[model samples]
Target: MSSSLLRRLSVGLAALTGLLGTSLIGIRAADAVTVPILVADVDSGKVIYAQAPTDPWYPASITKLMTTYVALDLVRQGKVSLDSMITISAAAAAEPPSKMGFKPGTQLTLDNALKIIMVKSANDIAYAIGENLGGSIDTFAAMMNETAVRIGMRDSHWYNPNGLPDPRQWTSARDMAVLARALIRDFPDSHDLFSISAIQFGRAVMPNHNGLLGRYPGTDGMKTGFICSGGFNVVATATRNGRRIVTIVMGQPSPRERDVKTADLFDYAFGQSAGWTSPTLEALPASALPAPPDMRPFVCGGKKPPAIEDGPGALSAPGSAAQLIGGSAANSPALALAAFSNPALRARSLPPRAPLQPIAVWIGRNPAEGQQILESQEAEQKAAAANTRAAKLEAAKAKRLAALEAAKQAREARAERAQAAREAAKEAAKTTAKPAPKLAAKAGRPLPHAASAYTAVETPSMPEAKPGKGLSKPAAKATAHKPAPAKAAPAKESTGKSAAKKPAAKKAAAEE
Candidate 1:
């Protein structure tokens, strides 16, 4: 941010003139003079009569003055032609009442649309102009804020293009008065559009809603609006006799009261035309007024809206404020005015949205409030998780039971196969044993003689030994008949004969 812009924003501190002082201004005098009164000289931008000009107030329909000012600037730059046709969109068609009854497909020139906005306080028409010119309401609002800053409107902010009551939407009457002054000064040529007392657009004739224009003489044009939150608000100006003065009355109870008080103010201002001095105005003590309720800031578009640059010669536009919009050759003032008289059908656009900022949250008492909320959420999550786990466990148990049943069936099949295998083995063995004995019988039939001899040999016994001495008596007799040895007698035979003769002689002698 530039130091100058910072200095401008720092001016917000001056806004804290105390809500108590503000409350005192709302009290009416015996003459029914109530609330903040700010009377200003339009040419000099000097405060002639001020009670609480700085005190905050809802700007209401007075915001349209700025809208008109920006539109006229575009017209001056030739970006928007006065007769350019604006095709209303669904979003613009959907704005809450105070409308021109233009359906979604209805079309109007830029000039007529401004007429509707000024006379009818038509939100739909205002949105139509913004959307057509700036692309969207949000984008148009950004341009509005930037324009406000450039024109030195410090105590103001715009959230929407139309001045509908949004809690976040707020502007001070002083800032509004500044806007009205700028409109009159910047586009003297376009000022007649505001003073139009009646407008007839395609069979719809709506009288100008500003009562002051018709009731108060020399009251040429301005705007008036009322919302319950904003009360009765008006940005009124008149060129009377020779002097032009602008009056801003906000938060008044009703339109009749606001108009009547404004008339009284104009009378006072007109009376002071004779040699008014600064010291006399400063001698009046400072009077306070009731501050409007704080509008809680809200962001539209459900999110932070995008920012947009202004078009041409505007701060947000490309190059410098004096430069024409790119691709525009209509540079001469006469050519530009001709283009504005008959603009391209596509030039209407929306205001921009508020600038993005950090979201602010208020904290309450009880130090553990955030923690308690977190804990409660955690408990709920845990319970849900437990239920999920139990469901999974039951599914797993069912799967296990199915597997066990399958295993049992497999075991029975295996037992049946084993028993069949054992029976087959037994039958095979019996068949093989019968074949061996049959082969043996056939072999015996073929070798009958050798078989018989084998049988006789098998019958032969081992020889026994002969009996010894313990044999029978017939064996003993055979052993006694054995022959004896012969005598040796040759020599002895002759000797024996001789001896026998001698023995015979001796025996004869003995017998004698």
Candidate 2:
């Protein structure tokens, strides 16, 4: 490795952040990162240069290389034709971004789908091709594995048709290089599919993710993929001096780093003497890494989701390697003279890209048919949006109704508790109550009737008859029955016989 690369890789990320200052905002660390690099000729399977080429690593979007191979193979087998219409299934439409956004029922030709996936890397388009060709993703993945094994891939497994962050899906640098060779060798007619700089669908233009497509000289065709888990990866090819070289790079910290390193390796391989002897891609020793590294922390701080770029300007067609990408390859050095003993092979800067030539990619059989599909998709999207709105409104109304029902239940519960309390009080009264103490019958008198026993009226609190302070017991007893009737008798407080005597005495006194 050039010392410039070593210097960049060796310095701690915290220190690099201090160097670029604000310019380093989105820079990622490739430090201690396992990178798999391979450069081999297209005609001969011999590798000119390699490092950890057989290590297990997440393939990211390069899985599309296999996707393209399978689609082309099916076309070759006459099982399907490129012009056949593929109905976008619901599963296809539901995939995450980097997609064509075609509705579930919308239809497009397989030819158009392949083009879109090659340049746009549309996850949805790749998936639709899989479903239409192989019946489903599971079946399609089996097809991918079968094709991989047939093509001499030793350390690769695939799950999804679009390589969207699948832990189960992985491919090594050698495997990718081998797959790229198969793509170039088997389908010579479809070479343009990989070199499209940009694809124009309707008015929107999407550039290919492969950085070297237009910037690097004689660079023909390839693919690039990124997910936080897998970092940045590419399977690229460049033809110079009647020689075409396929390069595979995996697990670089950023797209710029991946591109620069690939370009550097290309420079090195192109300069190497013809006697360079190295193992064929298939014969390289396997890496001890049992599984692909989770690169989220090093590449994206382990937080950002897949398919997001550091900036909006990336993935442009034939544009300057702007900033770290298309602008000057300033971030990647010319490999300062001291970094390299061989003065000729230092990493070179990428020039501002030639103006982008946006290749027109449309849907359906022709531009007119593609227009109809686009209009239909728009209508369906509107309907889907309206349905989504209606669902949200219904959900809100249901939530309100549920709350009202809960309140009603709470009120009923309180009323039930109150009724239960009243019932309980009545039962307690019955349980604790004793029949009014039976009035003790005095001498021989019959006990008073229940109603008369506790009357509402009460007796006078003071005595009616007055006695001398010191009267003999016999005298008091004699006077108890025959009290003297004073001339001014106090009016009786009761209406029984006591008040009648008071009235009679008053009347007698008046006559007198």
Query: Of the candidates shown, which would achieve the greatest TM-score relative to the real structure?
Result: 2
lDDT (Cα atoms) of all candidates against the true structure: 0.57, 0.70
Compare the candidates by lDDT and give the number of the best one.
2
Model 1, stretches more than 4 Å misplaced? 1-34, 274-291, 294-512
- Taking the tens digit of each residue's C-alpha lDDT, what string does model 2 give over 377-476? 7898899999999999999999999999999999999999999999999999999998786433444343334523222222222234367544245543
TM-score (C-alpha, index-matched) for candidate 1 = 0.49
C-alpha lDDT of candidate 1 relative to the true structure? 0.57
Question: In angstroms, how far off is 389's CA in candidate 1?
Answer: 64
lDDT of 1 by residue, 1-512 (tens): 78955554444222212211222332221212223456777876766666556544556566777777777778888998877767788888887767755568666667767877887677887888888888888888888889988987766778777677655566666777778888888888878777777665433456666667667777877887665445566778988767888888765543555666676667566544424453222233332322344211110112332221000101110110111011211122222222212211122222332222221111112225424644665698899999999999999999999999999999999999999999999999888875343212232243344332222111112224367634444443443332221322344453554455555545533543
Candidate 2 residue pairs that clash: 320-326, 320-327, 320-353, 321-325, 321-326, 321-327, 322-326, 322-327
Error of 2 at 13 (Å): 26
| Residue 454, model 2, lDDT | 29
